[model samples]
Target: MITIIAAIANNHVLGKNNQLIWHLPADLKRFKLTTTGHTVIMGRKTFESLGN
Candidate 1:
């Protein structure tokens, strides 16, 4: 299966300033666990968020 992970802000802003608004360690852990040994999928916009 494919897993998709995304981070959003309180104002429902996705990819603000081309990046996530906040960083949560737990969220990262969950995403890692969920996608472990599995294929991941995302859009170009999502990948671009990694820059900032």
Candidate 2:
């Protein structure tokens, strides 16, 4: 089973100007709870966006 989780805005925009449109705490919590210790998959741009 592939459980896909994502946040899509009303405008269907995932990002803009290299920043997240929404930085809600609940969203962060959900992401942490959902992907913790799990093998996550993302595109190159998404991976690159998360700088070290």
Candidate 3:
């Protein structure tokens, strides 16, 4: 099985100026829980946002 995760904002903006709009602790927890023990795939930009 494959699982995907992404962060979105109220204006339907995934990213702006190559950054996240807000930080939601609940969403962060959910993302961590969902991607646990799994591989995550994303664009280079997204990876850069993670400081990878």
Which has the greatest lDDT?
A: 2
lDDT tens digits by residue: candidate 1, 1-52: 4344667667788756756677788987898788778766777986575475
Per-residue lDDT for 1-52 in model 3, tens only? 7655767777889877877778788987898788778788878887786763
Clashing pairs in 3: none
The residue-by-residue lDDT of candidate 2 on 10-45, one tens digit each, is 989988886778889988888878888998898877
For model 2, the run of ten residues with the poorest summed lDDT? 43-52
Ten contiguous residues minimizing lDDT sum, candidate 1: 1-10
Number of residue pairs clashing in candidate 1, backbone atoms closer than 3 angstroms, sequence gap of 3 or more or interchain: 0
Comparing candidate 2 with candidate 3, which one achieves the higher TM-score?
2
C-alpha lDDT score of every prediction, in listed order? 0.71, 0.83, 0.77
Q: Can you tell me which runs of candidate 3 are displaced by over 4 Å?
A: none
> Which residue runs of candidate 1 sit more than 4 Å off their true CA positions?
1-4, 45-52
Error of 2 at 51 (Å): 5.2
Q: Candidate 2: which stretches are off by over 4 Å?
A: 48-52
Worst window of 10 by summed lDDT in candidate 3:
1-10
